[model samples]
Target: MKKQAYNPYLPSWEYIPDGEPYVFGDRIYVYGSHDRFRGNAYCLNDYVCWSAPVDDLGDWRYEGVIYPKVSDPLNKDGSMCLYAPDVTVGPDGRYYLYYVLDKVSIISVAVCEEPAGRYEFYGYVHYADGTRLGERKGDEPQFDPGVLTEGDTTYLYTGFCGVGDRSRSGPMVTVLGPDMLTIVEEPIFIAPSEPFSEGSSFIEHEFFEAPSIRKRGDTYYFIYSSIVMHELCYATSKSPTKGFVYGGVVSSNCDMHIHSYKPARKPMYYGSNNHGSIIEIKGQWYIFYHRHTDGTNFSRQGCAELIKFREDGSIIQPEMTSCGLNGGPLAGKGEYPAYLACNLFCKDEEIYTPLEVCGWTAGSLK
Candidate 1:
């Protein structure tokens, strides 16, 4: 008998998406929105975590529930589900969580002293006019907040989708005050030009979703899902908020095998929003993204692959793999969690997929 490789990292029962990976205190922790297994609707559960020592990706352990949906103010209206989030170490040496309430599209912040621990709701981001964004723009949406705390200042990157349109203010970066709560400056747009945004396939759609910001050497890498929607594209700049040049692509949620994707008459994997960051764990670089499971977007599971960068700082697209964090196949003997199965097959020749939180599925594509 041969050993099988693992992809989702955790056991099959745990469904987590929008994975944001970070390294702290000799351990690499993954923070992502918890998805209900076999459930409907995107991000139907709270935020949970999984982590492993920096030396061993195969030793992943559940970090328990970090944040609950019921604690959110929107829970009063029964419409709150935590979305994708990013955490940064503040100047005061605390971890700050940045995310948006799913329905309201309002960016909220949470704070805790430790990663993957209980987080207390902090506050909502506001504008220079002193009006909270949630109150000012009821119709307009501003969600998917990514934060980078460098030196004494923290930069918050947010996306404001134009109503009924995909393109809007381009990549926005705002400076946050010391509390990591209030906006310190008017948001600046790090515009992606025609050459950089090979992603803007639809003129009507721009800066679609999922943002991650990191600084390598002196260059700032602003990673997000551009107009291409499914693929994770990136732009780089010396400055965090301006002069961004599109740096090809990172990877696609459905098509991780290659970069050049032509429009097809047929469909692909259950395409959901792709959210992850490029983090250097130990000395290796990896692209962390999620894949749809059980033939539904809502039941998505997190997956990652190792990546290499060119001398020019452009990333080579990585292929989807079953050996995701593990580096190799698991031993034939040992108890493994359900989430780690990569090659799922049917019990029989029949396939009968069910409705997920999104309410519809085609019964194909495992």
Candidate 2:
């Protein structure tokens, strides 16, 4: 088959957002929340998986619906939905899927024999008495799970920024035993208040949801969408649960363009929240994130860019491009759709065009 590639990475019809990429065996599987095709509510569809071989960036295969919404306990009345999730291979050798039941305010668990296979309900992250953590704890929304396992010890990070519920705080980190279903310790407050700079206050790095944790060498990098709303930031610590210092902004869904959330001298393209993590595939590093379309936040798509770290561990943020996931620029001879663009916005007058974007589709290039 002829290989295909685009900026959104997947086909236009596939509206998978909040992508959490995990490399299992030879394929890099993207486990994320499903959005309706132009529908209203957020994350209105079932969980689907997409994967590609370690050597092939253009060949992506959909892994089918791994878990349906009806399978969730909170969806019994057909109301609640699952949000962004992360998968980690457990000591038992099974893949554990972690996500939150949005309306019910609880973090749930599911397990799959294979990385991209059907996942059955396992249990919920709860206290000793079996009461769910999110429901029993403070009024924070249980959303955007980031999980990791070191040897027999497993860690699950779940939290909400002020975005959903303004009362909510930064992320919470908890230890999961070898069983991968139980919370073994009291969940610890892990981020935001941690100083990111020499004199920066605790409020500087306040959370915005979408937590992603990765281990590079001896440093534990906790990546997430911050209060700025359009970009992803990171913090580094020797331990998974505490003592983290600010890293830097990784990438923006809007390409760091016209967004005014942080007083950009220039602005990012699409004004939407971004979520994704960094992973080393085939010895090369890449930052995975999402983009919005149809001028609405609901219909989002997954996007990625190759990134590299300096000798001192500083990350150089890459510019958003149509060549993402392709490893290089596409053939550049075929006609593509308008929404694939990461930069296409009009100025208040006819003045700003820093990205050199052409027209708004129909006759121009994306």
Candidate 3:
């Protein structure tokens, strides 16, 4: 019998958040920032990868440490942490991983011949004048890079704007040339930040961080984490870098805005910052996201939910569930682990996980 996929698809001890999933060849590989279990900071470990056959979602194999923290030239001592990353196949058919260090504002590139193989430091994304993308004059700091390549052009999405911070604009997109490192087009803001979202459609859910891009048919889907911090929202546009209208919440870690089963305002679980994107597996679409675990925000676990679209191209947000990626309910009733509980709460009706107890502050992204 085939195995059933459950939430936290990887081993319970692993904490990989900000997942970017891609189907290359016959398997689907997941690349994201690795987090140390119960660590003091986020993404304290090296970059690791996990993959499974396209036909079996439950049979995941560890790809080991594909990229180490010391691999980058900037951090030879490995003091800096690796933030969220995204991968794309370059024009030369080599897999390119784009990431940003926790202490830097510039994006870094790593390349490998195979999808899940070891990656070497390629170069930093720079302009024709050799200035780094984010270090140049009047350039916004880049964070959480998400890339999509078509033909010889690649669109790189990146930005991080805190609430009421006027110094930083919203998420921006820069076009990369065939070399995958040189900037072909200047950076442009694609969405409004919290301080500048007064008259925009994204006033309620302005982009905070985690900008991921996915294209289906002629529509471009921009998935990001909003200012709320617990939900993953999406926006769509016909063009790659313009005219994006805020859609709706994709998945909330605490089930915040879902009214199908309970009150829309009541949170079902302890949630904090969320980051993930959507992907299609075997003709079915799903959203891959992470949830806080071990009573702390540093240790997070990944989860997925089946997503459906209306004829108008709008997606209804899915509630947090235990039967994730199973395609439906479990077949037979049996004892399950308590960590699989989707609806977690105490008698006091606490909504969010206490960050102070975990030595985490409110506005700290890392």
How many angstroms is residue 225 displaced in model 2 relative to the true structure, after the best TM-score fit?
0.5
- Pull out the clashing pairs in model 3: none
- Order of the predicted models by TM-score, top scorer first: 3, 2, 1
What TM-score does each of the candidates earn?
0.81, 0.89, 0.96
Q: Which stretches of candidate 1 lie over 4 Å from their true place?
A: 1-5, 134-140, 160-167, 192-206, 256-270, 328-366
lDDT of 3 by residue, 30-64 (tens): 99989889999999999999998878887889999
Q: Can you write out model 2's per-residue Cα lDDT over 19-96, one digit (the tens) per residue?
A: 888888898999899988767778988899999887887788988999987777667665777788889999989999
Clashing residue pairs in all predictions, respectively, total 11, 4, 0
Error of 3 at 362 (Å): 27
TM-score for model 1? 0.81
Off by over 4 Å in 3: 356-366
Evaluated with TM-score, which candidate comes out highest?
Answer: 3
- Give Cα-based local distance difference scores for all models: 0.71, 0.77, 0.90
Higher-scoring candidate on TM-score, 1 or 3? 3
Model 1 lDDT, full chain set = 0.71
